[model samples]
Target: MKRALTDLAVFGGPAAFLRPLLVGMPTVGDRARFLARLEWALDNEWLTNGGPLATELEGRIADITGVRYCVATCNATAALQLVLRASGVTGQVIMPSLTFAATPHSASWIGLEPVFCDVDPVTGCLDPARVAELITPATGAIVGVHLWGRAAPVTELEKLAAEHGVKLFFDAAHAFGCTSGDRPIGGFGNAEVFSFHATKTVMSFEGGAVTTDDGELAEQLVALRSFGIDRNKSVTAVGMNAKMSECSAAMGLTSLDAFGETRERNRENHALYRSELSGVPGIEVLPFDESERNNHQYVILLTDHAVTGLHRDRLQTLLQAEKVFPQLYFSPPCHLMPAYRTDPPLRLEHTERLSERVLALPTGPSVSFEDIRRVSSIIRLAAERGEQIDAMWAGAVPA
Candidate 1:
């Protein structure tokens, strides 16, 4: 066993082996396509602020997401802020702390108190029951995050919001190609924000959009994204410059052309991970059964320290030494961040536990099935010989 372990440490030359993916890379031919579209933009001389390409991208997104209205923005964070501001969300907004900091920051940007709520242990999305408990007289809305392309309880959350006369919104940064049953993710709640950041399932380099069925809300969002200018050039509302540029729109359209292929790759990668990692002791592969469509992000939960004899961080360190890089998405929840810390803090039990245990393994179209098998083997062997792996990692480091 010791001899076999040593072989893994030196099996492949560090520089020669393909480095594990830490971010999403644009699909091949995206550059040429983007450049081709840019040529048209240069010919037309419409650079930004609702140019033709941007308008076309907006329409395409609306059509794809099955929503009546879609407004492109500079980024997901800005898209979120625009939705909240345009919806007249004031006072307190109940949201999950188990998300990117931008979720809470968007609320703060609109001068709303982000009351942190707990999430479901299995799904890592805002627990609808916990959200109900957190809502109060001051609560103006609920911001549920579709964490890791998993659908939150959209129907239940919408019902709750409707019953309470509060709006329901989603920070659907991970849900571009995801769906709830047959209905797509963006066609839910008051408005759902989809991120096109480079790391997401589909990307426009750096862009986002808000999907809604309400025409009035959509109009307000369009105005808010620009400097409050309507079609009549009337400065009717307070706004900012959050328009998606012609270049970004061009990239988005190009990326959209390849999303069908990307979605299939994501599904294949997820299946590979589950097939390889399932039945490994102490490792819990969260149920991927809820969503009919998933933009795969490989999140493995190290749920049992006693069974595995190693915590999540220790396993991460060992994997790093093995040239397998896994990320702790939302390691420190929003409430724990320096900017959002409060007096005595909020008790988010699930958020803290999930943050510590969750490890987002390298995934996406670029990652291979062999890569999944390798990562799984590392975890399986580490669980079998925890102390030995730790010793090996320690010895490899220069004193």
Candidate 2:
């Protein structure tokens, strides 16, 4: 493996020598609980289509999110699609370019033009000012994302949406357990959709849900999820089969049961990163507000490559060489995707810059304190080399 990596390095884009650490992993407790739930399911013989487990998961998730109603779906993308359809939104929906492609794809799939807007570089969320500037008579809604579990400026964006009389949708895929003061993420906006993908802090193996305070919309969502079927078992609306299966619901139930432990572990990892990476030159570890009760993702921004001889991509390669593989959350940003590109194209300077430098380190329940120390040391060494190179270049430049 070492020889292969060395040879690859010689030719550029080396073969990875060590077993790559993944960003998300299910714990042993998670496995045991999941098996127990499956056993219960096997005994009951209820498999899918809003079964008892699915209903319980919806209720528990609703309670956890502090929302009046929650409707679970097959995945967050389906949840987003359901929300956009139920809201009766049309024309254009303004959304941040610095997000997963699903955000824009949902809007476009619903026949609404997705107008990509820039985000605040620091938060990687919709900038209220930029959103306001982009609002037009044709604009019917605004979809704001809480990137990396970091809360977007919801209050400001809500105010802006209200003033314009446009519907506000929040893509809270990364913010399942996130809270804003006393209110959780799902309690905000016209509706907030969450992801329970295997990678999230909470996993359903694969599932999602949409939360809303409106009773009518909640009913519509429930119907929408199950092929628009009403209590009479008649198709009421044009809906598809996006309902969360019993197995996924079982997984979600256990995940919620185990959420506290997972969240705390992730938070501890965040603290370790802070302690190790703080004041490290050429690398900027994003700040987390302890007051906000966050499950932090280890996202570092390579702000000045000149100072850190290794840029984000190069640093990722070096980390892989050490068997520490990090993931890039949203590399090209939504606007840069070939399907979503516009005529002149949206020149989102901040989004472009962030896509170039943002890197997500190995995180979640599986990362250990020792692993954090090793990753931090490698980053520090890379930054030191970067600083030296910067100084050398400064000296070499002619007056």
Candidate 3:
């Protein structure tokens, strides 16, 4: 490999194009709106949760996601907590094992056990069948995350929830614009929450929201997010300040207007990656999110080590040398985290395998097709050179 023309902290190198993680990041116009809102707050005496800025952002998000009601929280984590608390959840909440750590943490926060279910290798969403099999006397709700950009199998899960008389919730953090059949994602479950962290698709710079068509449940969440203050002037229980600040909402309003362009650019970039990587020798790249790239986040399924002829860590390092930085999407499945140390993750065969092999590339609106091709070329090169790529990294100097 040639010398890195630019460090990842800057423009990145050929490796930059190859890697999933990058140092410098693209900007969000919505952020400017957030700054302006911050100015408005400063100009006035309002800050935190009381300003009009926060209200506007929530109202606008409710409009965009097509939900009848929306409530903004400090972050998606808080939003999930609010929902679970408001719903009065008790006992275990079923969810996929192959997701980010924060996902399962919510379960622990509310004193609910997180029952890890398996995933479908193709899409990486929770497997409803496995979820059904895991249902027990203590199970109260099912928390399904929209892994990658695709929506989880809502219809099946809903059926299972109904049969078992349990609630079903969807953690839609990765599904900013996700759809299921004819409707949007938030509409599918008993309740759904979205994340707007900077790295997410429709980031608020930092925020999360809960959307539901159920007017009663939506009202319950309202009280829970605002220190359990019943906005309706009736106190049902104790709640804390889980509200999104006015500034964050301002930024989100701006991103909402231009989110379409971002998703479109990413879709185009992904197509190029697919074209270049067809039929590679190591393993078949994942096709789940690929099918839904027209809408949500982008992700790749690495072929298992046995067939790919390469381990996930080795491929990651090889791509990093090319300046491409991919992440082991869920290096440690949530149930495996220290929070649940003794409560081991359930044996969802596919979810376990997926956590060990999936690697999501950078395909946000900012990434160009040129970037995609650059990354793909290095992968092809690795397949050609095989284990020889390891030699290149084994000899690198410590930085």
TM-score of each: 0.91, 0.91, 0.87
* lDDT for each candidate structure: 0.82, 0.82, 0.73
RMSD of each: 3.4, 4.4, 4.5
- TM-score: the better of candidates 2 and 3: 2
Q: How accurate is candidate 2 locally (lDDT)?
A: 0.82
Clashes of each: 0, 1, 14
TM-score of 3: 0.87
Candidate 3, backbone clash total: 14
Name the lDDT value of residue 8 in candidate 3.
24
- Report the Cα lDDT for residue 144, model 3: 90
Give the TM-score comparing model 2 with the true structure, all chains together.
Answer: 0.91
Q: Taking the tens digit of each residue's C-alpha lDDT, what string does model 1 give over 39-90? A: 9999999999899998998898888789999999989999999999999989
Model 2: runs farther than 4 Å from truth?
Answer: 1-19, 301-303, 387-399
Worst 10 residues of 2 by lDDT: 1-10
Higher-lDDT candidate among 1 and 2? 1
